[model samples]
Target: MKEANITDRQKKENAIEKIGEFHRFGSILGLERMNELMKRLGNPEKELKCIHVAGTNGKGSVCRFIYSALLANGYSVGIYTSPYLTVFNERIELDGEYISDSDLAAYTDEVLEKVSQMTEEGFASPTEFEVITAIAFLYFARKGCDYAVMEVGLGGRGDSTNIIEKPLACVITSISYDHTDRLGNTLAEIAREKAGIIKPGAPVIMNVDTDEAKREIA
Candidate 1:
C-alpha cells in the first residue's frame, strides 16, 4: 500500500472530516426503509456471520474489545459502531483497518444514489446514521469479512443492526434506564428490550448480573 503522501493520522483526520458531512441518524428507525436501502446495495450484511451486540451503554467499548480480540485471534473482523469518533469509516473497520478513501467515496456515492431514489419513491430520506450504516455493511461485505461485530446505535429492539437474522452470537451489556423516554422508564421494561438481542438458543454474555436488581433478564 503506497502512502497517499499523507500520514496515517492525516488520512484518519481526512476521513473524519468527510464522514461528518454524513449525518443521517435522524431518519426513520424502521426495517422497511433500511431493508429497501440494503436491497439497493445487494444486502451485503447477509454475507457474513453477525455478532449482534446491544445495550444502553458500554456498547462501544464492548465492540472495541471484541474487535481487538478478533484481530488478535486472526479473524477478519468488521466492526460497526455509532457516531464515529472521527471519520465515518472509523465506525466501520475491517481487520483493524478502515476502508480506503476511494472506497469510502464510492460507497458514499452509492448511498446517496439510493437515498435520492428512495426519496423519489416517496420514502423519507435516510438519516445520517442510516446512510453510514448502509455504507458499513457494504464495505464489510466488499472486504469479505468473516465476522461483524455490530453495536446498536439506539435501542436494540428497533435498531438497524437488528435486521440480521440468526446471528452466530447475541451479546448484551449492562442495561440501564438512560433512554427511558424512548426505551421505557422502568428497569424491567428497559431490560426486556435490551435483552431482546438474546435470540433463542443463541449464546448471551453479560457483565451485568444479580439476584435482586429488580431486573433479571441479564
Candidate 2:
C-alpha cells in the first residue's frame, strides 16, 4: 500500500512529538553531535552576540534579568532558558515575547528535516534540548536580535548551549552541588563545569559563594 500523505500541521506535530521523545533518550553531553546539527542548520549561533549564563541555580533568573536590562536599554534581546514554568514556548523568546506557536512549529519542521538528512548521512539525531537551542539561535538571527541571553541547560562544558564559541560575556551565578550526578559532587568540581561557559578573552561576572568554588572559578 502507498504511504499516506501528511499535512504541514501534521508534519509540525510529528516534529514536536519527535522532540518530546528526547526526554526519554535523556541528556547527552558532548559538542560533536551539537556541532553536526548546527552545521546542518548553517550555524546560527555564530551570528549572535550572546551573554552565556551557567550555574546550578539562578541561571534562569539571571537570564531574565539580563534580558530585561537589555530591553530597557533599547537593545533587541533574545532569551533562551529551560525547564519552563509553564509551556515549552517559554524557553525561546525575543523582545519579551515568547516565540509564536506557528513559528515554533515551522522551525521545528525545518530542524527535523535537517535531522533526517543527518540520520541519512550517518549522524545521530540531536537531543531535544539541542534542537530547541538551535531553533532559538536561528530565531534570534532571523529576527536581528541585538543580544541573546542564553542560560545553560546543563553543566557548561559539554552543554549544547556551549556551541556558541564567542560570547560577549560569561556570567556564572551561585555554583552549588545541585547536579552532583552530572556535574560532580564538590564545589570545585561543580565550579569547573559552571566555568566551562567562559570563553577565552570573555569577561566573567562570577558570584560564587563557596571559597573553593570562587577560587576554582577565578
Candidate that would win on TM-score: 2
Per-residue alpha-carbon lDDT of candidate 2 for residues 1-218, written as tens digits (9 for 90 to 100): 12322354455566668689766657888888889988989998999999999988789898999999999999999999988887677889999798876678888878778888988999877888888888888889889899999999998999999999999999998888787888888989989888988989999998888899988888
C-alpha RMSD for every candidate: 3.5, 4.5
10-121 per-residue lDDT for model 1 (tens digits): 6555544654555544544567777888888888888978888887778999989998998899899999887767655677788868776667767777777887798899
By lDDT, the best candidate is 2
lDDT of 1: 0.75
Clashes of each: 7, 0
lDDT of 2: 0.86
Q: Stretches of candidate 1 above 4 Å error?
A: 1-27, 210-218
Looking at model 1, which ten-residue stretch has the lowest summed lDDT? 209-218
